[model samples]
Target chain A: MTEPAAPIVILDKSQMAENIGAVARVMANFGLSELRLVSPRDGWPQERAWATASGADWVLDGVRVFGSVAEAVADLQTVFATTARSRETRQPVRTPREAARILYDDRASGLGVGLLFGGERAGLETSDIALTQGIVTIPIDPRHQSLNLAQAVAINAYEWRTLILDAPPPRFREAEPPAPGQLLLGMYEHLEAELDAGGFFHPPEKRPSMVQNLRVMLGRAGFTEQEVATFRGVITALSKGRGRVLAKLAAAKRQD
Target chain B: MTEPAAPIVILDKSQMAENIGAVARVMANFGLSELRLVSPRDGWPQERAWATASGADWVLDGVRVFGSVAEAVADLQTVFATTARSRETRQPVRTPREAARILYDDRASGLGVGLLFGGERAGLETSDIALTQGIVTIPIDPRHQSLNLAQAVAINAYEWRTLILDAPPPRFREAEPPAPGQLLLGMYEHLEAELDAGGFFHPPEKRPSMVQNLRVMLGRAGFTEQEVATFRGVITALSKGRGRVLAKLAAAKRQD
Candidate 1:
C-alpha cells in the first residue's frame, strides 16, 4: 500500500507570529511540513517566528501565504476545521481522532488533506468553515474552553502521527479520491448562479446563509471528480431546459 | 458505572512558572484539576504563573507542592510518567491513548491515577521514572522531538478527556485497585533492606541500578493491596529463616 500524505497545516488570520512558529514546530514534530498562512495578522517573515520554532526551520522556510481560505485549500481533496465550540452549520462535528482517521483514509486513497485552524481570537468565520467538509472539536472541559492555538494543532497532529505510527490495517473500503477543492468550489459557484437566476434563494437578506447551507450540504458529499462533472452537467441541462420551456411559453402567449 | 476520577498531573523539577501556569491551563481545559509540583525551580506562588494561567485560577489556586516525586504521588494507585525519549528502564512505554485507557480503567476500578511530567531541560530522572507503573510516550517525528512541556500535558490530558467523553463500556475485566504508592514504597524499602543485609546487590557500584531494576520490575506488577501484604510477609519469613540458619551454624561451630 502507498504511504499516506502528510496533512497540510493551514492557519487562517493567525494573530501572533510566535503561534505560527509554534505551530510550525509541532507540525515538524509530527512530520507535517506544509504550513500555509491565510492573511496572517502580522505580515509574514517575522524574526520572532524563527526563535520560537526551536530548530524546525524547514517548516518555517517552506511556509505558503494565501489570500483566502479558498485559495489555500484549492488543491486539497479534504479539509477539517478545528473549532473550540459547536457551530450552527450542518457539518458533522468530529473528535480529533475521528478526523485523523478520515484524513488518513482519504490520503491513502491518493487525495490531498489539510487541517484548517482559525485565528486565536474569533476562530474560523462560518464562511471559512463552510469550505471544509467537517468540524473537529476537541472534547475539552466545557468550563475552561481556553485552548492555546499551538496546543490545539499539537493534539490534532499527535493524533495523525499516532495513526501513522500504528499503521492499522485499513478497515475502510478503498474510495475514489474526492474532487479537489477548486473543482468543488467551481461546482458551488455554478449551482449557486443557476439557483440565483431561478429565484431559488428567496428573501435576498438570507442569500449568504442560504448559499452557505447549499455549499455545506454538497461539500460533505465527498464527490469524486466524475461526480462533480456529472453534477455540473445536470445543472446546465436543467438551466437549458428551463430556458427552452420559457421560450415556448412566450411564443404561445404571443400567438394567443 | 461511577464516573472515573480525573487523573492528577504531577510535574517534576519544572523550571519556569510560565510553563507551570500553561500546564495548569491545559489541565483545566481537559477537566483535570489536581496539580502537583515536585520541587519547582522557582518557589511556588509566583505572580507570573497566574499571569500565564489565563484565568485558570481554580487549578493554580489548588496547586500542591511536594519535595519529591514519591511524596507527590504517594496516595495514587497508578502512575504513568511522560517522557520524550525512550528510557533504559524496563517499564513498558505506551502511547498517550493507551496510557489514557489504562488510567481510565484503573480509575473505574476505584484506583486513584495520575500522570507525571518531567522538567523542561532534562526530563524525568531514571529514579523518578522507576517509581511509575509505565511510560507515556508521545510518538512524534524523531528528527524534531522538541515537544514543549505544556504541549505534552495537553496531548495526554486530551486523550484522557476524550476517553471520559466517549465513556465506552469497559472491555477488560474489573480488577482490584493496585496498592497505593506509599504501600508499594514501603514494600520496596523492606525488600531493599533485606537484600542489602544479604549482600544480594553485588559490586557495590551496581547497587543503585540493581535497586532500580528491582523497583521497576515490581512496580509494573500492578500488585493489589492484599498481594502487597502477602509479598511483604514472604520477605519477612525469608529474612527470619536466614537468620535462624545462621544462628544454628554458629551454635554448631561453637560445640565442635
Candidate 2:
C-alpha cells in the first residue's frame, strides 16, 4: 500500500514572490508535493518567483490559492504556525520532530496536516498565530527576528524527514539497508549457532554470561539485519574452513 | 551614565560575506560595537559586504580576526552558540532572551559575553556547539529553514539587547535602560499610588480583590517601571479632572 499523501504547506499573506519560490524549492527538496498560497503579493506563479524556485516548478504549477489562512487550513486536522517569537497564548510547544511524528502518526489514522507560514515583513498576526495548535520557533540571533520563509520550512522539513523517512518499515529492495530488528535476530542466531558448533556451551557454564556478552556487544554495535546476515555468512564461511559440518550448523542458525 | 563597553560578535567560518555585512547592519542597528570574523570565506571587509551592510561600516571597522572559535571567545566568560538545528550533544537549550539574560547578568555581575555564528551552509560544527555551555534556537517556518547569517545574528543581538539593555527598553538608544530590579520596584510604587488615589481600591470589602486585579493587570501588561510611572501620573491627573477622567484614561490606554 502507498504511504500517506504529503502534508499540505500553506503560506498566508506572503509578501515576497521570491520567498514563495524559495519555499517551493525547499519543499521539492524534501519531496513534498503540494503548496497552498494564501493571498500572495505580486500574484501567484510570478515569473520572478518561478525563476528563483530553480527546479521546483511543479510546486508553482500545482499551487492552490486561497483567500485566508483559515480557508487554506480548513481541511487540516493538524496545523502548525511558524513564528520567530512566542506568544502569551499557550499551546503544546514541541520540537519539529515531535510535531512531525504526531503528524506522521496521525496521517496513518486518516488526518491531514498543514503547516502555515506568514508574510515576510510582519509575520503571522495574533489571530493567525492563535489559529494553530502550536508555534514553531526557530532559534536565531536576538537582534534580527526575521527569517527568509523558505529557510524556515527547510529546517522543519529536515526534522520531519529525520524522524519519519530515516527508518522505513521492514521491506526488501534489491539492495537496501537491512531492518534493525531483522539484523538483531540474525546476529542472535549466528552467535548461538557458532557457540554451539565451537562447543561454546559444552559445559553449559559458558552459556549464560558469554551469550549475554555477545548480545550486548552486538546491541552496542547497532548492526542492521543485512549486517547481521552478512556477519552470519562470514561466520559460516569461517566455520566451513574448519569443516563442512560446522558450516551447515552455522547455516541452520538463520532466524528466518 | 555612559553605556558599558561595546561587546564583540564572532562569526566562525561564515560562508557568505554578504550575510556577514547583513549581520553587521543588524548589529549596527542595535548599537552593537564589534564584528569579529573567524575563517570567513572570500575573506572579510569585501566591497560587496560593505555595500550590503548599508551604513554599518563601523561594524566592519571594529572587526577583529581569529583563526578559531576558542581564540575568539577566550577573553569572554560567556559564549552562546546560535544554531537552528538541534544536536545530540547536551548543551542547555535556551531562548535567545534566556541566554542573553545569563550573559547580561554575568556582565552586570562582571563578566564578558561572546556570541558565535557558524558557517552559512553547514552551521556550527558539533565541536563548536559543544564549546558553548548553551544554545539558542530560533523559532521559524519548519518547511523552510533558510535564515541568512546576518538575520540570525540580528535576532540574537535584538534579544540580547532586550535582556541586557532594559525591560521594555526603547528600540534605538545608546543610553542604558533602567535596571530590572529598579524598574520592577518603580512599577510597584506607581501601581500602589495610583490604586490608592483613584478610588480603585475603595470600599474595604473590595480592596483585596481590586488590588489583586490591579497587580495582575499591570503584571500582564509587562509595563516597565518608567511606563508604570508614566501611567501613574496620567491616572493621578485624570483623578483631578472629575468630568474628564474617563476620556483621559481612554486616551492613555489607547496610546499603549
Candidate 3:
C-alpha cells in the first residue's frame, strides 16, 4: 500500500477554470486531494470545469480557497515553489521527484508538506518564490520552458504519484550533501597551508593580493571537502621530492 | 529490421518558436530527423529558439514549412492527430504507443506517416482533426489532461523512437493504407449484395434511396475492406435461414 502524505497544493493567482479543474482532476488521478487556491480569477465550483474534469468532481468540491500563497502554506514546514525560471535565490532547488521523496519521508514523521504553483499566465511572482524553502524546476529544453499551469502541476503530481504508488526501494542514497559553509572553510584552510609550505607568501606586500587571487580561484572551483583533500594529497606527494629543491632556489633568489 | 518512415511533424499555428526549438530538441532526444512546421504564429527558425534548443540546431535547420494542416499532411497517408480532448468523430483513438505501432507498420510498407499537434492553448481544431486518419490521445488523468505542446510532441516522438529502436522485428508486412474511395467501394458492394439477398429493397422505387442511406451509414463506419468483409460475414450469418427477413420485419412493424 502507498503511504499518503500531507501534500497541500498552493496555486497563486491562477486563471482558467478548465485548467483549475484539470489540476483537480490530475491531483485526484495521482491520489492527491488537498488543493489550496490563492486568489483565482475563476471562482470555485465552476460548471465549465465540471465538464472538463470528467470524473474529478470531488477535488473541485474539496478545494480550499486562500487569500495568499503564504497563508495557503502556513501550516507546512517544508514548501517548494514550482518554477522553470532560475531566479537569484539562496535556497536549494530540487527536482520534483527528489522533493517528493523528502516530503514523503517527512510526512511519515508527521511533517506538513506543501508545493506552490504560479498562475495560468505568468508563474509565481518573485515574492511567491521567495516564500518557499526551495524551488522545484522541471528539466526541460531551456528554450521552450513555458509550461502551462496545469501541465506543471501534472508533472509535479506525477513525480509524487510515482514515489507513493510505485512502492519500490530507492536506487541509491548518496552521502550527505555538503553544506556551503563547510566547503568554503575547507577551501580557505587548504589555500593557507599550501601558501605557507610553498613560501609564495614570503614577500609580505604580494602575500595579501596572492592570497586573494588564490581565494577567488578556489571559490570558482567550488571545491567540496573531498576534492580539497585530494588536492592536499597531491601537494604532499610533490613535497616529498622537491620541497628542499624549491627552498634552496628561493634562498638564492633572496641573496641576489 | 525497422524501416524508417519519412520524417514529418505537423504543428498547428504554434505560438512560440522557442517551443518549436524545444520540440526539435525533444525530436533529437529520441533520434527523430525531420521537422514540419504548419502555419507557425511566431514564424520559422527564430534565433532565440535555436539558442534555447541547445544541441538540436540541426532539426530547426531542416524544418519543412507548410501553409496548413492539409498541406502538411499532403504526402502522409497515415496521419495521427494528437489531442487530449475526445470529440464526436468515429476515428480510431489510440495512445502514443498504439499510434507508434501503426506508423511503424505503415513505414515498413513505404507509407508516409505524420504525427500532428495543435496550438498550445486550444489544441487541434475540428478541421485539423478531420485531416488525420485517426486520433492519438495520451492517457493522461481523466480529471487533469494537461500536456503542453512540446511535451505532447515529445511523448509521441519518444514512443515512436523507442518502438523502432528497441528490438524491432521483421514480422509484420507494411502496406499502404487503402484509400477512402477503395474502402467505400468495398462497403458498397458488400452491403448491396447482403441487402439484395435479404429483400431489403422490396419496393423498386424505394430501392435507390435505401441503398444510398445504407451507403451513408457504412461510410460513417469508416470501414476498410477488411472491416466491410467482417460486416458482410455478420449479415450473411444473420439472414441465412430467412428468405425474406426484411419483409417479415415490415409485417411485424405494421401489426404493432
Interface RMSD of each: 43.3, 40.3, 46.1
For B143-207, candidate 2 gives per-residue lDDT tens digits of: 99888787888888887666555643222312222223334344445555544543344466976
Predicted structure with the largest TM-score when compared to the true one: 1
Clashes of 1: 0
The sequence of per-residue lDDT tens digits that candidate 2 reaches over residues A1-256 is: 5565566788888888888889889888886769998898777668878888898898888999988775676566567787766533333345666667656655655656777888888778755554455677777788886678898888777766665566444222222222333245445666577556545454588565445434432342323344455445434433332344334334544422
Ranking by lDDT: 1, 3, 2
Candidate 3 local lDDT, residue A141: 87
Ten-residue segment with the worst summed lDDT in candidate 3 chain B? B170-179
Model 2 whole-model lDDT (C-alpha atoms): 0.62
lDDT of 1 by residue, B152-219 (tens): 99999999999989998654423355688889899888878877766566789988886786677557
Of the candidates numbered 1 and 2, which has the greater TM-score value? 1
DockQ each? 0.01, 0.01, 0.01
Which candidate would rank higher by lDDT, 1 or 2? 1
Docking quality band of candidate 2, CAPRI definitions = incorrect
Candidates' chain A TM-scores: 0.92, 0.62, 0.63
Model 2 chain A: weakest 10-residue lDDT segment is A170-179
TM-score (0 to 1) of chain B, per candidate? Answer: 0.93, 0.61, 0.68
